[model samples]
Target: MCGIVGYLGKHDTKAILLDGLKELEYRGYDSAGIAVLQAEEFSYFKAVGKLANLEAKTADFTTSGFAAGIGHTRWATHGKPTEINAHPHLGDASYVVHNGIIENYQELKNALISEGAHFLSQTDTEVIVHLFESLLNGGLKPFDAFRETVSRLKGAYAILLVTKQMPETIFFAKHGSPMIVGVNESDEKFFGSSDAALIGKCHRVIYLEDGQLGFVSRTGIHLEDAHAAAVVPHFASLPESKLSAQKEGFRFFMEKEIYEQSEVLSDTLIGRLAEDAILFDELNPSLLEGINEIKLCACGTSYHAALASSYLFERLGKIRTSVEIASELRYKEPLLCTDTLFVVISQSGETADTLETLKMAKAAGLKTLVVCNVDNSSMVREADAAILTRAGIEKGVASTKAFATQMAVLWMFSLYVAQTKDTIDAETLRKQIGLLREVPAVVRVHDDLHERIRRLSKRYLHGHGFFFIGRDIFFPLALEGALKLKEISYLHAEGYPSGEMKHGPIALADPELFTIALMPKNLLYDKTKSNVEELSARDATICAISDVPFEKADDFIPIAAHDHYMLEFFETMVVLQLLSMEIAIRLGNDVDMPRNLAKSVTVE
Candidate 1:
């Protein structure tokens, strides 16, 4: 994934573009660049590292004279993170910045070379500009050249192009990666990879849909289909404070987001339950009639959310459900039908694999429902229905509050669906909903565990392996806990069902190993406690997370002893996420932007 920003307005182009790039740097930070059009020429500057380096290099320039420009912060998929692969790929006649992959770039490069076109960088994006230049040389307009060039390319992309011939306007299109057009009170137009990039500058935005093209200028904004048919724009107000993108006072975005769980969970559950203490009204009976099967698709932490949903649906709703990784589901070509309802989960609805899976499921005639944190994402627009998680903006590469909030929404979705199908009685649903309302307060009790988790991290940094064991709904939390440790700390971690530990995972236990057991108080609590004893007997250092302390465990991180159906689900996750962040910090790692990982996966 990469970050892109384009502005056609009265402000200083370079200053505005750089500010936008800094706000969007969570998307990518391997390299940065900017291009501004003044008169009939494009002036460019680029660097091989963070945006700060590029800004230092261009500090002496006069960008106030230029009225239009585009900037990029690259993550480098097709090429290495070097100066040569940086964005703002320039041609003789135009400059282009792109996010996503070009699958047929090699073939296009070969054809362009045969046709006497020169190449400068080892990037698939360079081929795009070269192909556009070739079309312009054949006497095509800038808009027509972009359309023709895109018709010949294959794969996912959201690109912004600026031409010397059309210096007053910027052209952009989207197929996979996210792009949005914003209009300010001053009537200026702005475009960027995400709404956060243009928040304070422009409050009203039109999020681009797949296969849609747009032309933006200082005076107005226009959108069109791939074949040039006119289309309308949908505008939405920006969040209350543009400071949502700022870290405020925290050491890192991850830390700030970890503490935001209480407010976000409260917001997500607000206006959802009625005064009669029932679930929301949006999940009507018509949506659940004869829905025989559900396929949950997601990636990374969102995949863990789907697993949690599977457990809830089976236990409460008695429905047959299958959880699939979104990337694998697209290639496996699984069985899908009109009777199947596909539930796609993603923190950022622009996740490439999840979006692709949703497109394929829709094409197969299955009704799709999106569970996401962002309001106007591509998946929300394309899905038959959407349940928004009010977690606000999650800037961390490793998700904290978003993952917890996603589970909250999924739990509510399961309860709503069960009520709609008449599988669960009204009294049971009301009890569960009441418990859901208390989750935020329950999670707040674990806030004091931060220092304790940091102390626990020191013991596990040099340890060889980590084992997380849980029973019932806590199994998903165990898996997610292990994943976070492994993803950032580079430690070997495994999550297994407590009963399954005897099968194979027990062989690696030793005194140097750390075992995190999620012992939430449920029907399976006693069985999970026995599993902890098994690990302790093998000389494994035990860190037990539960409502009550166990004498056999080495350490106990106590949570609120709530017997609500979903309260333990949310509390255990809070402790796990805080533990992972502490472990990462102990290893001297960047908790917000992990190495080699972007906040959004916009490429396959």
Candidate 2:
């Protein structure tokens, strides 16, 4: 993933671009660049490392009359992360910054070379600007050249371009990646790869649909679809709440997001509960009543959320449920029937593999439901029904609030299915709902526990490996915890069911190995503790995350006990997330951006 920001306005264009890039650096950090246009003058600056590097390069650059510009922070999908490979690639009379991959670049580059166009950098993005310049030289109009250039490309890309020919205009288009256009009261325009980059600058924004193009000038704006047909733009209001972007006194975004879980959980369940029943009116009871099986498909952290929901669907709804990673499911082509209900979960809702799988399920005539955080994401638009997690914006590459909100949404869906099928009694449902209401208060971290987890992080930061083990629904939590740690802390970690510890993972246990045990106060707690003891005997340092203290554990972090399994799952996840954050911070790692990772996975 990469970050892109462009502006067509009367302002300090360089300062605006830098500020926007700072807001969006969480999406990428490998390289940063900016190109600005003022009157007849053009300037470009680039760097190979963090946004700060580019800031230092542009420190003395003035933006007095600059009114148009584009900037990018790249995650390095294609060339090496060097200044030469950085974005804002310049052509004959234009410069461009891009996100997503240009799949057909080699073909286009060869043709451009044949046409006497010389290359400057080893990047697919350079081909785009050169192609545009060549087309304009061939007497094609600006819009026609852009449309033709897009027709020859074959992959996800969101690009912002500016040319000397169109000095006051900014051109932006996207195929599979996310883009938004924000307009202020002055008719000035802002565009970015995500809403986060435009949030504070403009209150009204338009989310660009796939295969759409827009051109912004001081005069007005123009939008068109893939076929070049003129289109009307719809704008939506954005949340200006300071909490959306500020650290709120926290040292890192991972820490602030971890603490935001309390509010995220409450927001997820807001209007979905009745006095004694869970409400999911989106699902037709008559349709789901006859469904015999449910399929949950997702990728990365969302896959773990689906794995945890598999247990809830089976136990509560009395339905046979299966969980499959989206990347693996397309090749498997598992059997499906009309009675099969397919559910896809994603935080960005634009995950390429998951969206592909969702399309395949729809083609097979199976009714589909999607649980996603972004409202108008491609997955939500294509599904038959949708459950919005309402997790707001998660900037951390290692997700925290999104996972918890997904769990909350899935739990409510399970209860709805059970009630619709008459598999659970009303009294039991009421009790569970009551306990869920108390989850927000229970998930808030205590001062003592926070400091204790912080202290425990230093011990394991230097460990050779880590193993996370849990039983029942907690098994998925174990996998998710391991993923968070490995992603942010750069440590090798694995998760396995407690009963499976002796099978293979136990053989890797040693003094330098660190083990995190998820022992929720459920019926499986005793068996999980027994697994921890087995690790202890091997000289492995055991850290137990549970409701009660574990005497055999080398370090213990207690989660508040909850009578219901769903609430227990919620609090257990919060503990592991905190531990992951603390360990990454202690290692002096970039907890938010992590190495070789992007906030959104928009390509295969």
Q: Which candidate ranks first by lDDT, i.e. highest?
A: 2
Give the alpha carbon lDDT tens digit for every residue of 1-604 in model 2: 7889999887888888998998888878899999998886788999988999999999999887647899999888778999988999999789988887898999999999999999988898999999999999999988688788877788888988898888998888988788889998877799888777887788888888888886888888899999889989988887665457788788878888889889888998898889898987666666584688999999999999999989989988788999999999999857877799999999988888898899899999998999999887778888998999999888888999899889889988888888888899888889878877887887787888888888988888786898998999988999999999999999999988999999888898888999898888775888888888999999999988888899988888887777766677777787888888888888889888798898888777
lDDT of 2 at 169: 89
In candidate 1, stretches whose alpha carbon ends up further than 4 angstroms from where it belongs are 275-277, 445-447
Quantify all predictions' global Cα lDDT against the true fold.
Answer: 0.85, 0.87
lDDT of each residue in 62-164, candidate 1, tens digit only: 7665477899999989889998789899889789999999999999999999999998889999999999999999999888898898888889889999998
Look at candidate 2 and tell me the lDDT of residue 577: 87
Range of the 10 consecutive residues with the lowest summed lDDT in candidate 1 = 275-284
Model 2 poorest ten-residue lDDT run: 281-290
